[model samples]
Target chain A: MIRARRYQDARAQARSNPELAWWVFMRVSGVVLIFLVLGHIYMTFLLTSELQASYSVVVNQLAQPVWKIYDWLMLTLAMLHGVNGARYSIDDYVQKVSRRVWTKTLVYGLAALIYVLGTMGLFIISKAMLAG
Target chain B: MYRAREGQWAFALHRISGLLILLYLLIHVVSISLVLFGANAFTVLHDIYGFWLFRVGLIAVTGGVLYHGFNGLRVAIMDFTGWGTAVQRQLWYGVLAISLIGLLITAWVVVPRILAGH
Candidate 1:
């Protein structure tokens, strides 16, 4: 009975705070990112020699549509996950609301810029490969 | 703020590691984007990453990623499931243990290879 009540209370608390949703997102995304990132590291670093990781190797890999999607997913998830985490820190450390708002605006702007650029890079590379 | 317990330390470390991973992601995205510039730009960047210092940096990144990834799982279990909250502390310790052991194994396998520049 007590355990159930405690669980209910925790759930209630989470529901009450909007920020808790982001917290949940962090956990969920973190789990997914673990698989994505570890796989990426294994494939990029461990699967090949230094020679194999050369520009040509990367170009070849990006030439494949599947690899492009895989990388795009990795970039998108990582940006959202990390940016939300940083926003949490900003909320915690910055006492003033106005300051927090400004900081978050800056953070979000930068994240958007990076995400756009990354997407463009992936698309451009795919097009270049297809053309050549 | 200065005095902290095990859980607090864990939280702090998670935050730091999370931030580091994010920073690295930013750099990784920009660098990989260089592929669009053609072969020479991409290969030049790859050559820089092949240096010993960057290889050493990879160890730190690997460690950070392991801890954050495992700890994030623990946090997720606690948040999304009923049973996990009951043993949250134990789960955290489990995360730390796994991270340490996993990192040790990774370093053992990777460090030598990186050092020898294969």
Candidate 2:
């Protein structure tokens, strides 16, 4: 059947590179992100009014090591999962091989920059909370 | 390009939502980074987000995340498992149904709170 052939193609494609691994990762991470993000929204927005979700409240939360780790994990998974998904779109739409490479390079570069900045912002706030 | 089929539209939504989330992430990182400057700076940014208009925007974000996360799961299942592809179209509908219900519930809960302006 066509399904079997498509499955075989997927297996072969996965064998050739790490694309398959990432393909699987997207799903797994996506499920986890759903919970994490929903929980985050509930805690940040639903649990309290805007007045209560002040800078001090956030600082107080991040001061705890657990929150710091939870947020970092959320950030890491979200970035990797999202960037990989975008890469798939880029590869599919970009016609020329050379253009694809350049586009991916640019995309990856921006992703990395955002990741680093996010990490720094997260950790620095944690440190500041701890010290002060 | 310009395909109006369900699958194609789903694909397009996934791409668009993913990119929008990425853009939001960049802004979120930069805004949070303002905390490093001082608590006053961070508080200002936080207050801006607390504005009712921004809260409404967040409803759209919640919808985007719900759709993307659920649809991504469907896409993943189709790619990984044998049975998934067999019922892929059904699964897409299932995803839409679940996401719609979820978004509606979220809007139901959030809109009133936003209107209260608290």
Candidate 3:
């Protein structure tokens, strides 16, 4: 069958793995982050600053437990997103098996560590703020 | 089974992390909206955020924010830039190294300050 022949070709000649997935994602997400990040910057950096932003102001804003949960989650997501995004781009550029493994291992491991710490920190702070 | 290498791992992780960020951003927006909407909500956030546990969380979250935000810029550049082509391979590692170093430095100062405050 033509399909079978094409499949064989992919298996025999496609190096180690099909990278079409990551390639596709970087594109789709690159477009999204442009808006998410830009709006984020504009809102927090630009607008927040002019409107009497301060520690107290932040505290005032964070008054809701929902916001605390929101921040904790955002912290986790942002770390994972950025790290992964970088990895996607990096993999396309770097092909050395040894280096890539160690590098990605390090990136992911560190990111995981950061997420744990951040979650705990946020939880502790929120509890304190709520209870205090 | 063919073992996937480091590059592959990084690639997989990147996509997973991206999805995570989308969720996190959603939560953040909803939470902040509480404060924007009224004084009562703002008071609750202010009190909870000041707690020792919350302060620690703030530091960790800040680290994530810096890393994600900065590293994103790195990715965008590597994908789009001429320099990325010339130094292409080295760029990602270079960005990763700088990010780690930058995070460490920022944490050193910020973490200690938070600790001192507590």
TM-scores, in order shown? 0.85, 0.84, 0.44
In the order shown, the candidates' DockQ scores are 0.54, 0.56, 0.06
lDDT of 2 by residue, B35-110 (tens): 7677888888888887888888777887888888888788767766778878878988988898788778778888
DockQ of 1: 0.54
* Positional deviation of residue B39's Cα in model 1 after best superposition, in angstroms: 2.0
- Score residue A117 of candidate 3 by CA lDDT: 52
**Model 3: number of backbone collisions:** 21
List candidate 3 segments past 4 Å from native: A1-132, B1-6, B66-78, B81-88
Q: Calculate the i-RMS of every candidate, to one decimal place.
A: 3.3, 2.8, 11.2
**Docking class of predicted structure 3:** incorrect
lDDT of 1 by residue, B1-118 (tens): 5877666777899989988888888888888888877777877888888787887777788888988998878766765677877787898888889888877876786778876877
Task: Please give the lDDT score at residue A47 for candidate 2.
Answer: 68
Looking at chain B only, the TM-scores across the models are 0.89, 0.91, 0.63
lDDT, candidate 2, A22-52, per-residue tens: 7557768998998998888777756665457
Regarding TM-score, does 1 or 3 come out ahead?
1
- Please identify model 1 stretches exceeding 4 Å from their true place: A1-11, A14-21, A49-51, A96-99, A127-132, B1-3
Candidate lDDT scores, in order, read: 0.77, 0.77, 0.51
Local error of candidate 3 at B44, Å?
1.0
